[model samples]
Target: MHRLIRRPKSVERDLDILSSIDTKGLISRRELMRRSALFGAAATLSTFGGVLSAAGQEGGGKVTVGLDSGAFTPILKTFAPEFKAATGIEVEFASYPLGNMYDQNLLALRQGTARFDVFDFWPNFVGDFGPFLTPLEEVGTLDELNFNDIAKPFQQLNIYENKIVGVMIDGDMFINTYRTDLFENAEEQAAFKGKYGYDLAPPKGYKEYRDTAEFFTRPDQNIYGLVEVTSFFVYAFFINQLVQLGSEKGVRYGELFDAEMKPQLVNEIGEEALRRYAELTAFMPKDLAQAMPWDVGRQIFFDGRVAQANWWTDMPKGAADPKISKVAGKIKCARSFGDVTVLPYGRAVGIAGNSKNKEGAFKAIAWMQQSAQANRWVAETFEQSLMDPWRNSMFDDPKSTFPLQSESGFADNFASVSKELLASPKAYLDISIPGTNRYLASIMQHVPRAVTGQATPKEALEAMTAEFEETTETYGRDRQIAHYEEYRQRMIKQGYWS
Candidate 1:
């Protein structure tokens, strides 16, 4: 049965002081860590039954969640009955289209409507949604929420201004997937080495990646070098390359913006990233200019028409599914090329501040994420769910299963590569300050110009930079600067390079 495990009164007071000191910028990072550790210990030693009784005693109630239409929605619907049976809290969803999810959720919160007790949102929306959501720490202690179980990169996504703002429900980092049959073929390897002057293997850098793509392209055979999402959400793909390029060039903070909030993409590094991006299109499908990751990208890869694909973790799992993929056992996974990999999109669950049933909402979130059995079920049902591994236990535990673990040759390999990628020292977090969606939308608008030859890479990046500058000014430069500083500092503390 679900139980509300509240922090002790003394620990709560200490947390308030800690939060205040952190907010006022009066505490050093090291000291903050020390105090946080002590507080964690104190809370763990405290009681878990003082605030509320067991779910059986609390009686039946309802908790409505705000969600977008996606793979996650169906999973939640499937598991709702289980949660209700166990906790007596009926799970209901207020579904919205993905395109308008942010607006609908924000409108409800801004109006203090209490329309949803819980929200399933993109983690990048933390800055905009933070004030309207209750910190999970207040709903439950770190121990109760199993905070330490989450991966380091995703752990940082849950925190905003030192408060635990949400819990990561999906681990959506970009990974490189390729056809092992192509790479391992004796004739193909020999031919590649003879022509490129090096042994053929999975690419480790941009130069090798480009050469590999060019070598594999054979239009007459219906084979191409690569496939990637290039429409609508294309900005994410662009950022993936841009961040790695910046990391390789030793650009500061991975080169999205400077300390003063100036755009960094109007420079040489940005141009080169876009140029390489555009060049790759030559090795992709003819219709790639309008491809989306969910359909075209996956369809092309699954049809075994492409040798390589850089996509979210879902690609490897989907590739292994024989029902939808002709390349089932021929796939392999690795970190995206370069010194660092970018985390593009992921979902997080949070309780609404205006909810009358905050306790029930936290129970639902905890049930889905903190419960070991439930979490494993979600992660393993990859074909039916988009949830990827975000917890250490999911990978470290021998008994934990992945999609088609016994049947798919690459299941273990994908898990291993995912663990390595998430823990990589050079992994870059996405820009998640206020107006992050708008900032990314600007890139989406300008990227097509470069990809379609309507504008040069420099011209496109210059246009994007101008839009970024205008957005910063529109959002109030000083306010955005403060938000970025706090966001960057948090990322630094989490081991991401500046």
Candidate 2:
């Protein structure tokens, strides 16, 4: 037998009035906070109360969330209590390693275990887990979730088969981070122009990027020209170059696959992209073949040992932090080399299809992704949270901009470059069809072989192409074709392509 606890009548009345005031926009968030504090409602009410009421789950309950271990673990834990206060709901998290998170979540969802009410995962995983996830629209209205405030590129990421399946939580794209001190030095600039017959600045094309990388390689001084993730996830780097190459040639869908669902990676463009990617190894760390993005690649840049690195959006925040970075105040950001940039590994949150409390779960997700919360997360230093700005409001909000502004122009440069990248017609979406992980794994396997000289670029891509076909066929070629076509259509609709 269980005992039921209830809120006092006065506390319940205060919460109702607070919820009404918030819903009607009678006060600003700060003012609401002030009023709640004055009424002593801060101990029992949170801003989430309105969202819970909107979801028709204003009563108390508990929902379990599934999350991968990392920066998000601490953030969610810190906010859980606030959520509980607002709606009288408890948030229990089941954390898993990043690598196994997909498998674990998939297993539980498919098993109908109701193990998790919400799942926080990479946007691409929506393809594999769509069947087991609840459509967000069913739980709350778009306005209630503040859906339109999210970035355009990430908006498409949260949809599956024309239905809203998730809420964008982390905005991610590969951007170039370089040593400002090196690039601004007059001697280096003149020497670069004399040698390369072009101005010394951030690279505008692949050839220029290669030239820049080669020109900056000074191993004796412990400074390398370039570094990027080159390990198991090297596929992301390869795809970035591949998409840029395809966009340059004005090919649709970045030439990843054809209308017939045949992979295009065995062609001349594929070989060239692979070769160009492998060529950069000469100017990178000798152990580049096995380097992971976060551990080896980012650490090298933060240590001021790399002249330039193309990494995730969070790189600038880390670079600006004096506590963990040797390059603080000396770093500058630019869009990755190309007419197009690749958006990769962004995370989103979705309610589980098997959840007993879908409304409660969505309320939790909405609360986390609300503009104020997202802005706060973006305002925090990278060491505090890995979340990047995913909402338009976050970009313009003073709270979010002030911290980055104080970092000596990092905020302005990052915000400008990020807005351009996220809104560009040349922005390429990562493949998010079913079996996306497997297809990318195939690239991960062979790209390293070429980088290590175990195989030629052409040979490595040929093998990867074959494996891609097998993966597509294994999942049923016709079915995969439809999924890819649907995904392409969404990308085009979202202005990612023509």
Candidate 3:
């Protein structure tokens, strides 16, 4: 994977945009929201109508939010006009490329300039923004919404230094998406069974997965068995396997660190995970080094060039879309792969403590997450977008899968598999705390080296362990150990360890 901090994330480009807009003068609420009828604004209009009616006159403000230029953009862009019309808050937004957003948001928040009111916050980076973000509990929910409604894993993520720094914004977990066309092919399946002594099907575990990958590698037919990805996505692949391998091998890495906060990333489990990851590189496209960037691999798979890849659960929506995917209607999702099918990821958002319009920002968030809007985001899509659902309500709703089902053609299959996997006992959660980013950066550096053959998996992990120790020392081992202890307690309370 490339470095965690892809670039400087300097806001020099943002400053140029800032200079053009007059922050000193507020735009008239009516004028700003005048174009509210964009993107079937029906769901929001009635909700905001009463608020606008109560104003009697123009009594609105502006709320600028920020997002990574990924999933948030399409939905946010569609909803902005309605939010503006309802609250009289001119919605101004800025999006950084997904790779650079973490550092970009950090620069903006640390500089004490609330460049955006409502900003996207990933759990892993929430600790870094502790000083600058308003705790969710401190602000209170918009309509007394129960914070308990979100899944326990996600709820656990928002707690930082005993405070709720962010709220879950999207539901994400990795799962295997493979072309059913290939797996179910009679000739291919028979050949696979003959060769590997198993039916050609979705892998129940990494071992079977490797065998399946090997059976499908046919470079001459211009078809690759898997798509290898780099950067943070690759890290997910490595760590998820490591976590799973730990249990099967009778060495659980579930707790990540021991009671003393010593990293357990250099042991047998780490070596095995790295070895499996490196082995997968052989089945990836021939043009790339080890793997392609996530976007590249995704497109390759959609074009029917690659057979399978482990990616976010939402990938099937794109794979099944007839309009864009060459392999439309041929995708299938497997909920569980014996242990954790794939790693799960969750993102949370918080209002900047220094936000110029916290009230509007809060309202915007509430509006965006409302049932209708949430459902629309799920169903309404012409392309693959982020709008990943996080709420239990969404998961339970039969109607929520329509949009995805429409695109992926596995409406029932996707829903059942996804819900089961999401609630799987083996789901892996990302590390969240002040020093995690730096520690993960240390990992990002060494693990990829091992994958590319510069170092042995054990050697790379040894270097990772040393660097992790140094980072722990730099970030105060005592404090971090306490945080891990606190997380442990939460896991116990929630049965996350069970």
Q: Give the winner by lDDT.
A: 2
Question: Candidate 1: which pairs clash?
Answer: 253-498
lDDT of 2 by residue, 1-498 (tens): 999988788877876666565433323557555545433453224454544454334545789988888857777776665566555577888888988877888888887568899988888787888888899888888887898898877777856777888887888888888888999899999999999888999987888889999999998998999887788668778888888887777776365888788989888789888888888888987765455555678888889989998878777778888889999888888888998868888888888888999888987887777665566556655766788778887666533443644547677777787777877777777777789888888988999889888999889988988999999999999988888898888777766687
Worst 10 residues of 3 by lDDT: 32-41
Alpha-carbon RMSD, each predicted model: 12.0, 8.3, 10.5
In candidate 1, what are the lDDT values of residues 1-498, reduced to their tens digit? 999999898877756654443222222446444535532423212211111223334445799988788757777775565466446677887788888878988888887568899988888787788888899988887786787888888887856666888888877888899999999999999999999999998898998899999999999999999887778878878887788787777765365888899988877888888888888888987866445445778888989999988888778767877788899888888777886867887888898888999999888787676545444454445556777777887766423446355445465787788788877887777777888878988899888789888899999988988889998998899989988998778767766774
Residue 211 CA displacement from its true place in model 1, Å? 1.2
Output the lDDT of residue 238, model 1: 86
For candidate 3, lDDT tens digit of each residue in 392-490? Answer: 666666344354454344766766677777676655667776777787777778878988788999899889889888988888998888877877776
The list of candidate 3 runs beyond 4 A from truth reads: 1-60, 142-149, 341-345, 382-384, 407-409
Over 4 Å off, model 1 = 1-60, 290-293
TM-scores for candidates 1 onward, in order: 0.86, 0.87, 0.85
Native-referenced Cα lDDT, model 2 = 0.78
Cα lDDT listed for each candidate: 0.76, 0.78, 0.70
- Ordered by lDDT, highest first, the candidates read 2, 1, 3
